[model samples]
Target: MSTQTGRCYCGAFHVGTKASPQTVAYCHCSDCRRLSGAPVAAFAAFDPAHVVITPRWPDAKSHAKGVKRWFCPECGTQLGATYDYLPDQVYMPVGLFDQADRWQPQLHSHADSALPWLHIDDGLPRNAASSRASLTMASCDS
Candidate 1:
């Protein structure tokens, strides 16, 4: 029954959630890197029913099949995303959360795609590809 809130870079968009995240993890896929403009991107997956976006969620854009992303119209900050495969959860960038420090990633997804220069020896589980099975199980647990 914890609540987390955050706003977009330009303060044009806001988000809040009443429940804890189902999972938190790092994504090293090229798609995520380009979208986040970072070597790696971390996300916290939440049940859509527990999350609220002020004003409204922007229209989603799908550059890749099965993946739809939303961005703030004012500053273009990546807002959130949903995957057709993971219909029940929405993935929001960890950096966008006011309590980002509290949501450390539990695993590395698409580890094989991770940049060679990036060395994170946090001893977290590394999945060579999408950790959909693990992610799905985590949601079920919640």
Candidate 2:
């Protein structure tokens, strides 16, 4: 794993990791697009504790599904996505990184929510609220 660093658009959020993630993914869920204010959102999966986040909030403002979306309360910047089901890992948005080249997407999730103009040629596992979503529920503490 290579070292990677990231911060929010306004520098309100900062994260550091030793993750040279090549198996990243594209997410096209409506919630994601709306939340990110972009065509799509992409992230790299990593060990939850491998990341050292500063300005840590005791409570993160979140939107929940099977997972929890944490945002910077001050700036409303989406910081990272954490699975209530998978506590051992979390997905950090690639765009937040100052050094983003090491992580390249290997798959696309929520393909059905993808926009018409956007095209994904990569043959990866896709979910229109798919397995990742399902697995999240499956792994839940219900």
Name the candidate that leads on TM-score: 1
lDDT of 1: 0.84
Please give the TM-score that candidate 1 achieves against the real structure.
0.93
Residues 1-142 of candidate 1 have per-residue lDDT tens digits of 8899998999999999998788999988888888888999998999999989989998988777777888998999988888777888999888888999899999998898899999999999998888887766121101
| Candidate 1 Cα errors over 4 Å, as ranges | 137-142
What digit string (tens of lDDT, one per residue) describes model 2 on residues 1-142? 6668887767777888876652477778777788788888887777766777776732654455566766776677777777665667777788888776756666677777789998767677776653355333111112
Q: What lDDT score belongs to each candidate, Candidate 1 first?
A: 0.84, 0.68
Worst 10 residues of 2 by lDDT: 133-142
**Segments of candidate 2 deviating more than 4 angstroms:** 122-128, 131-142
TM-scores for all candidates: the values are: 0.93, 0.79
lDDT of 2: 0.68
Which stretch of 10 consecutive residues in model 1 shows the poorest summed lDDT?
Answer: 133-142
Best by lDDT: 1
lDDT of 2 at 70: 68
